[model samples]
Target: MTTTINANSHKSLIRNKVWSRLRAVALPDSRFHHDYSSFIADFEGSSAATDLLQSLPAYQNAHLIFIAPDNCLQELRYRSLTDGKKVIVTTYGIRRGFWILDPEQIHESQWQMASVLDGMENIGRHMTLADISELPTDIALMVTGTGAINLKGLRFGKGHGYFDLEWAMLYSIGKANQRTQTIAVVHECQVLDEELRGEVWDTGCDFVVTNDKVINVKDASKPSCGILWDKLEDGMLEDIEPLKELEAIKKRSRAG
Candidate 1:
């Protein structure tokens, strides 16, 4: 774990340098101006990557998808909704927790608006783990803004660790598993050739789709144990309501 943390720190330094170069030279347009401390890859040229993801057989067959609330993935969510798939997203900061967006549950006029995270309240239904019914082969496609990712399937999110937390929650509830196919859509510039070591908590994606290429990460291992609450920073439980709920569930299960 110490080694993983150190490696992540080293990777982060390199990522910042790469992201700075990209933001300055590769993406200087007004559309890419985001003021967050975490560098979000400019969404200007991510359409091709989204197109490739849409063409995936797994994506086409998935009825339920959990897409992150990200600027680059807005079009993907829109397309998924249009295809009549059930889309679930995290409420901002998981303050109100997660919600489900089904094209059938929302009015046709609001289908486009449903794709927007801020507009979710107007068109989505708040859902709990119990609300979801498991099918034999449910797919999870995560839309992540990465600093860097390697060929070994190791990936680092924009430093927030929200994606990892979400994966843990889903795995704990049995909604996602080791065999459940997972993929990430990133830009070609974000892919790194270095050997990235995976932490016990980090989930490995089965495939990574870039604007210019498709990488198949064979024999990648995802998290098996679910939430590593011990490793979380203090006050995370108080910050995220869903985590509190999950803790209560875990307690009850253990007590019984």
Candidate 2:
């Protein structure tokens, strides 16, 4: 007899299993930090990365954006080429999951000696905690992810909830759209076939890129709004000061 599992339950099981395995492997030597750099080099060396990077639909007119490292590893490679276009790099702080930085800041930094360090720093400048209302509508965003987590539903980050919060805020203000593509970079090991559990506010990336392939996730049945304000618990809003100050959220609430 075959048993059917509900989407949420299946996701929870997968997350628990995946997290346990990942934590075990990821905690050993922090080798992921350097290993990912080699992964990037291999990716760049292959036709897959070259073809995908060159064929991105958003490459023609993106002005502002966010990009992240594949998995939790800091590969330190600049996948997004500005080509003189305005670009922003999303990064993580010592205490936060991700933040935005300007490209120019990385270009002028001392860390530029190593190609990987230079790439990471350059992408750091576009990092910002600003609300979707504060960003340009024409902006394009690329978020990295390890395929290990089930993305069809809500998947937990290492610890911080910044990725969900940031994506949720953008969706709340109607800033996330076709023009705004959320891309995930990952290795083959990280990819999963199961749908994860999702809350009302859960958001999924629009694309998944890897050394071997690129998967378009726009058709996936996940959260569309990105942000589900009503589902947020009490005191949650107080945790992130920047979210409170977002002009769009405040403006809409005042008008209501």
Candidate 3:
């Protein structure tokens, strides 16, 4: 109890510092521009990081990618479609499971609109883990935006663990694997110099791309053990429909 409390306190401090630093360079959603809003900030030229990522060999060769739905990642999601890559993204809050956006499915002019939260729903195909079991095993990238990250490659976001759970479900269902590279896109200010330890459920990234540079991480940790069932936040399994569905699917797979 004591350890958890201290950790939470520390995280609160870091969150405040990160938000302050980031707000200077990025625009928070208009609805959330207030003092306490925790929405990820979207910068005018944040797409520069997306361009940097695309120039990399891994991205160039990748036919599939998984991107988070955070506002900061909106541009990458759009470019992935325009580049003719199949994108896998969780719905906002991941409340609705995974969706796949194929450039072939939508008209070229709508690709940009299709990248946003509502546009994705209107244009992408909703899918379950079972539906994705047939995807090629060579998914090239799993990218997410973070509230704060350090040189140690440790990252956290909104205290929700949405991306962590999304990774766990994908891993458990065999849709994502160790070879699927992961990266974090953040403002340069969100990259901290101090090192921090990662929890067992903390899925760290291999690369940290910022507005200025892409830092290659030496030993970033990833969660291979899948969801820590016992450690999940209260009501996660109860409130999130897809998580419940995934739990059932994984249980039956083990039983069989």
The number of the candidate with the highest TM-score is: 3
Q: Which scores better on TM-score, 1 or 2?
A: 1
Of the two candidates 1 and 2, the one with more favorable lDDT, higher being better, is: 1
lDDT tens digits, residue span 1-256, model 1: 6896798687787677557545542443244364333435445567888888888887887788888776667778888888988888887556677788889878778888988777887789987765654544354555555555788777766666777888888888888777567777777767778776667788777788888877898987778878888878777888887788889998999999
List residue ranges in candidate 3 displaced over 4 A: 34-37, 251-256
lDDT of 3 by residue, 117-186 (tens): 8898898899888788887655678999988888877886788888889888888877778777888888
Candidate 2 local lDDT, 9-119, one digit each (tens): 565465556554444334222344433212221222223543564467755456565444333323333334334333433333212323444445455442333124334
Question: How high is the CA lDDT of each candidate model?
Answer: 0.73, 0.46, 0.82
The alpha-carbon lDDT assigned to residue 13 of candidate 1 equals: 78
Return the candidate ranking by lDDT, descending: 3, 1, 2
Clashes of 2: 17
Task: Output the worst ten-in-a-row residue range by lDDT, candidate 1.
Answer: 23-32
**TM-score for predicted model 3 compared with the true structure:** 0.93
C-alpha lDDT of candidate 3 relative to the true structure: 0.82
Greater lDDT among 2 and 3 belongs to 3
